[model samples]
Target: MQFTQLKVLAVSGSLRKSSLNRLSLESMKLLTPTGVEFLIYDKLDQLPFFNPDLKNNPTIEVLNWRKSLKQANLVIFARPEYAHGITGVIKNALNWIVSSGELLGKPISLPNLSPRASIAHAQLSEILSVMGGDILESCSPNASLITPYVIPCDTAKNLCDIAVINHRIRELWNRIETAMITK
Candidate 1:
């Protein structure tokens, strides 16, 4: 099977301009393979708090968020943990789409930059699983464990080894291509 294009939507849990999670995903945009469309979703902060009553009459932001999710062949999340759990921005975004089923059976990758963030990673996995997402383990590479010399996100500069970053991005792109081709 061959694919002309593979659409991947990258979401960041942190809303800060210089967040490591956001920067890492932004950098991956440059390394995407040919015929792959990688979009970094930068509107988690724009979404309103989820309310079951508003599911039928969602705001424009909610509609746009769901549309992005529906159009992508796969969704990748680069998120930071707050108090040992996923950030509120990501949680809220997921909540908004949970009832609508945009993520139902959708392939998802949640890559972690820090080894100590395992708790948050597990939480995210559980949530995505409950939402009916196909959590792709192949795409969720931990930057710290991938490269021995690389340090975790303790500093802004020493995020991860360049080789690991490239490898992870390529792996993700390969998964996207494979999934698209198989579908």
Candidate 2:
């Protein structure tokens, strides 16, 4: 049997340069099996606010964003909740893609790095549902207490949890079984 390689497009919802959400996505990339590749979309800050007025003629950045979605076999989002909601950049990206049929029937997963992510998770879930994204069940690492505020780079406790998440992905995503079978 032959299995096609899975291309996962991982988007970090946080815009800060030191976002733990981005770090988690990077870590996920490291943990994923050989047949799966996670492409971290680092251009959130480059996208402009979504304007329904401009849907007919989007900018080059918007065009590129849509192209990325179209090329991926799966989508992954790593986010830190802000004020009980998904970050602005991510929401904006979603808005831009709303008119285009990019997210329709797409399999999207989100890894929550904040214990306070309950509301944001539900909100994003509803949004993804409306956008027609198939949210993969129990696939995200929703294990964290780190706030969306400011966390230094030297936080060991959080790092330790993140380490476990790396292992969790393999177990939950069934990459281990897939790897064993492929071998």
Candidate 3:
């Protein structure tokens, strides 16, 4: 299949009902170019912990999650920082995916929306890369997309930043499209 027509799966790290990270991932889906499709996994909390003891007797949900990752041409991760690091939920989810062997060499981008920019973003990029995910690009929103964690007040300005983030996403897809052509 050509990259231009590939399906991209996006998963948000946060489970908050109004999570900015989830909003960011949805925005990416809305902004994706024609011929590309984005599917957001809303069941992060349903995944059990990664355990070798239970690898063979995996639950149906875990099996389905792995199947989705295998089918996706690329993965987009939008995460939030908890206590100056990636949340436990997101980290655990990554742990489960790592054992699937489907993520090796897959193109990925980790654009975040957080108040603790430098530390959280830097650490997450390293972690994902070390786990064999290709971290293509990352960005942190200057302002909170949700309330009470205000870094700024201009929604329009934040929307502008989101536009740039979407462009990078399209660029990644274009690369995938090109790679698909040669293969």
Candidate that scores best on lDDT: 1
Compose the digit string of candidate 2's lDDT tens values, residues 1-183: 223577779898887655777766665665666666669998978888888889999999999999999998788887778898888988999999886889898877766666777788888889989999877755654655543321334432354355445455556457323432433
Per-residue lDDT of model 3, residues 53-121, tens digit only: 888788887888888888887787777777788778878777776666767887775655564554677
Off by over 4 Å in 1: 1-3, 145-161
Q: What is the C-alpha RMSD of each candidate to the true structure, in Å?
A: 3.3, 4.8, 5.3
Instruction: Report the lDDT of model 3 for residue 175.
Output: 59
Tell me the number of clashing residue pairs for each predicted model.
0, 0, 0
lDDT of 3: 0.66
Residue ranges of candidate 2 with Cα displaced over 4 Å:
1-3, 144-163, 175-183
lDDT of every model, 2 decimals: 0.78, 0.72, 0.66
TM-score of candidate 1 to 2 decimals: 0.85
Using TM-score, give the best candidate's number: 1
